[model samples]
Target: MKIRSLAAPFRSSSRNNVLFLSTVFLFMAYATDAQHSAKGDMATEQKIHALISEMTLPEKVSLLHGNSKFNVSGIKRLGIPEWALSDGPHGVRAEVNRHDWAYAGWTNDFATCFPPGTALAATWNPALAYKQGLVLGEEARFRKKDILLGPGVNIIRSPLCGRNFEYISEDPLLVSKMAVAYIKALQSKDVAASVKHWLANNQEEHRDSIDVTMSERALREIYLPAFKASVMEGGAYTVMAAYNRFRGEWCSENNYLNREILRKEFGFKGVLMTDWSAAHTTVKAALTGLDLEMGTDKKDYNEWYFADPLIKAVEEGKVPMSVVDEKVANVLRVMFNTKIFDEKRREQGRMNTPEHQQAAYNAAAEAAVLLQNNGNLLPLHFDKIQSIAVIGDNATRKHCSGGLSSEVKALYEITPLQALQQKFGARVKINYARGYEKQSTFREGNNSGQSGSLNVNWKLIDEAVAVARESDVVLIFGGLNHDFDTESADKQNMDLPYGQEILIQEVAKANPKTVVVIIAGSPVQLAGIVHRVPAIVWSWFGGMEAGNAVVDVLSGKINPSGKLPFTLPVSLAQSPAHALGNFPGSDLKVNYEEDILVGYRWFDTKKIQPQFPFGYGLSYTNFSISQFSTDKTGYGKNETIQAKFTIRNTGSVYGAEVVQLYVSDPLCSVLRPEKELKAFQKIFLKPGETKTVEMPVKVADLAFYDESKKAWNTEAGDYILQLGNSSRTIFQKVKISVK
Candidate 1:
């Protein structure tokens, strides 16, 4: 599927015309539909549809694939100019040739790396997510990239899911709400946004072939909601299908997901493209609602499937002509919505605005969470603290740390070490040590190391211990990286790797007032010193400027306001997904026995507590929860119970607190979690500021999948809603009856 070879079939100008014309015809059909007739905006859409009808099939297909350097001429007659494709969820990967082009690689100069997706989710503020999206859109437009291939919305199913750092949450509702805001903000800026890795794209192992066989109930309830929210609510302009399969069929060509679910059910009026090299069957994909195949070495799927096999299917009635028209119409619709025809984007500058960089910094700052701060260990006053010791491999190197397509070149990255020095020069003594090195760095050949040896490097531990003894306070930075953490080909247990544990132990021994910061992508087991560490910060590979963001929080320049998006597993053995075995393996038939039970849900349902519950995070300032009560006991079937609480900032400093609300189903036909997160509110308060927050819990929020009943409904019983700062700590509760 070389670009040159794929280009051969699409050479004929006449063939390209057919593809374009067919799409126009379909648009006309939709425009004339009774539904559009009722809508007053039919004239504009109809004109664009009519214009699309004049294009040839090859031209239409060319539009499906974005304008690449190898192609983009067929649609010249339609005046569709070439549009460049670029990368960067953290920062723009615009550099022509950079090292491996991954999280650690150098992005082209000018592209600012913001905090990672999980970091934004850590804020638990959709408004902030939207603001970040607006920044990403501005940056993308400046770089002249037509579509920003980002906002990976895969579920954080397991702590071991390597790419979990890039996704939002274990709960679908929160992820959906956050994603919708992000998409809306990005698209509002006129930059095409792609909500990606559609449906059950949870694991990295055997990702290309793994069969995600969850019951339809789980699919709709847990996995598909965020995607639906992004498209249906956010009006995302594009969607990228995953490299895996849903049920028995490949995701690109899966009819249920692509057609029945995404298109018909959810009404996703946008371009549906395949993940790079993710396309399987050509004609089947088109028939199943795939409008485009991206980065395919230029596979002329149109000639191989559409022009020849596609027409043959129509002739033999195996594939309807209407299907081709639908695909083309969808493509045209995206182009129209993007204003691809009316405006030229080349005039826009590339990575020149300080506003963009500031946005990145703001996003990073907002997403920084203070996971644990016992005895008020954080907001380290530089004047009061004379010395600081930074220890860990993460302290030295910048790891964008995740999986496939995670690479991006940051115009400038503020390493934690660099940021600390920049903010507190000569004023504070800073000692540093590398707690661990990449396993391959110590190996003879490519990456390889024994599992037992993959903890904190022992030699590095001794140096860090010495530094900790001399310093006033110690900051131990260590966590998983792509080499040791990811869903890709390489995977590891959810434990601190290679001597990091030993380093933490030694450092804690040397300095009892030590703070531990994790820089991995997802939650990891922190048993060795979970109880010993006075302050613990879970920093999910905070983006290009992550280093600076971490420094800001540590130094009290920026208050830590982020919250945990996933639960920290006490041990790999206790993880629900672990029982299923290494993902995409164990005979390739792994079942989600936990079913709708995910993250804290599984832990609570099975009564297997985690080291840290989901939504757990400590603040530098103290806050108290009071006045907890529901407005009413019970009402109509759809009526909601409002739980109001007044949160007072009792500490001396300003800070933010996340108020979490959970609902419990006392009894049900199927097994259910003891309590599930129904709603949450993040409030920022100054010293002594008290705010009354209200959260509504509706009957619909209590529904669960009852396998025997084969339906989701609220069981008739007394339901309990608990309001707390974390899953394990319930500060307030209210009992209600569902009729």
Candidate 2:
């Protein structure tokens, strides 16, 4: 069966029955194909072993460490090419110096900047992620890079985490589903996709040294799923070790995480590399399943931990020669998988093409979440309004150049102001005002000046207010910039910096037709203006075509479909991490006090109302979910629960809705969350169109990690499946028994 065709409607039960029969036949064919593929894989593994046999010990050690900033040493005599990696989770980062962080100043390195991780997650469409990955892989191949160090899947433990923008979501299932599609697409072009931050590298504060402690259940259930899926399902070729320590040991040298979980449990065969200067010891790191050591900040390459020290350790009988061979084998395996030895067979990619730009635009357009449309003051009709007032510094600031490692040298970045002027310049008048000035500047690994200043410039606010008063409609683009969203440092609080709260309040008071467009990657405090603004749009850090995408959504050219990947708490104090006062813990030690209760899980279980719930977004059109039912009332532990539901687009427009399936075990022996997201599907429909959506949930997936028994347990009891657009908006519920 074609996976893409699964989105099509099944009008009757008979059609569904036919589809199920077809699936059975498809599985039989797939099994035969898998056997043939297994034979091919074994041959490839034998070839990799043969290549390792010819390599000298010194040559093998050279392959395990970086010889330059972004390259691994290769033996020219053996026809082995060097592995080049690019820093990315969004787009191909500009080329840096061979030995330093300075740009190489290459004019040809410009790339098509795509939306960041949070924006892609908001789309809730894995197809778009696959498309974006294809673009990224093509560009990486064009740049002659073998590995794209990207698609960070770390759980969004706290909104204040500096790298949350790089991560996908708080929910493991959402992150897993999106990441698998991206990795599969990227590797299809012969470029390796490096799934990162192997363990809980949640917060950036003291990241290089912080020791993280969490329960086994949290590690197995909350953190490990996405990484496991990335390796097993996505077939990722490389993994990046996080800077932070897991349970008192640096992730680069953690045996339980790297060897036991990643290599053994997940059966990952790819090279595991460090996150730049994360290596702690030579012997420990090499023996713990670290295949490569990259960017250790040493001026002399030979002095790096995995270089001379590793060689010395082996010669002194401290680290076995067999360990060296194992590391060499892992590196050669990825090299063979990516076809590095056969340059003629590898993909010769294209850069900054129209197709790549279109993928970026599609991601940006579908990612703008309509947080609130209180007065329906959106879809600004040109005939109804003549002049539009655009306020706030974010309206003109470009985001493609910030965020340190994820920054892309885009061919061009059109800001909101520029897009508005270009799209509506001929027919409408647009006024602009910089309501706030950025107070900080960010360099690689360093943030200078203060961004937490609450000082408001009265003169700027007055100008913004005057502009709003004269215009027929007001659009305030206010939110955190890279200073608050970049790597290395986390934001101190959820408040909007540069006195944006006061600026927004003043601008909204001037014009009741105000619509606030927040361009941020993470959640920010919206309580100040949520009640005052007529409409609110959470537009993430859109890439090159950010302006065009946002304008299309506001003009009703593209109905908004982006949803919140993480819950927007009314206050930071309400978040599980902060509610327990255990964030960025003391003395370089942190505890996962919240455990499996993260994001919506905590809010729903505690019954605490949030400013906005997870998987929540608004569209110009409306939809109604009805006729929800399950195929069976009782299911065995090995059975799959097939949920069937009918959704109708009742409004007079075209749009897409993400139907979320959340499962709850209300009568469990231990404490559990109110509901956990299991399965979801995004269905697009025109006006008056009805479609049947079928989502399958495995009975095994309903099990909770039992820390006492060190295994997952699904108690034989009643379970409820709730269907909804968002966590808080359950449209229907059906009960079932799992035995």
Give the top-scoring candidate (TM-score). 2
Of candidate 1, the 10-residue stretch with the lowest lDDT total is 441-450
| Candidate number of the best lDDT | 2
Write model 1 residue lDDT over 1-739, tens digit each, in one string.
Answer: 3333444577576555756666676678877886665663466568657766886655555566534322222366777666555555555555443212223333344566666777778889887788777777777777666677778888888776667777888888789878888888777766677888986888766777787788766776788889988888888888999988777888888998988888898888788877766777756787788877665544444443334555556667777656666776776666666666766642353463677777777777777767678887876888988999988878877765234455555666777898888888679999988767756332211124325545446677788888999999999888766665443543456667776777788788889989998887677678887777888887767677788888888888788888788777888777677755535456665566657778888887787878888887777787999998888777556777788888999988888988999988776666667888888888999999999888887777678766667566777777888989887888888888777
- Candidate 1 Cα deviation (angstroms), residue 350: 6.6
Q: Give the TM-score of candidate 1.
A: 0.87
Q: Which residues of candidate 2, in runs, are more than 4 Å off? A: 1-32, 443-448
lDDT of each: 0.73, 0.91
Q: What is the C-alpha lDDT profile of model 2 across 1-739, one tens digit per residue? A: 4732662566565677767777877898999899888987899889877877888888989999999999999988888888899997889999999999999999999999999999999999999999989999999999999999989999999989988988999999999999999999999999999999988999988888899999898898899999999999999999999998889899999999999989998899889999888888899998889989999888999999999999999999999999998888888889888888885956899999999999999999999999999867888897678999999999999999888889999999999999999989788889899998887666545444444457789899999999999999999998988888888888778888899999989888889999999999998989888898889999999999999999899988999999999999999999999999889899999999999899999999999999999999999999999999999999999999999999999999899999999999999888899999999999999999999989999999999998788888989989999999999999999999987
Q: Counting only residues 3 or more apart in sequence or on different chains, how many pairs clash (N, Cα, C under 3 Å) in candidate 1? A: 32
Cα error, residue 246 of model 1, in Å, equals 1.7
Weakest 10 consecutive residues of candidate 2 by summed lDDT = 444-453
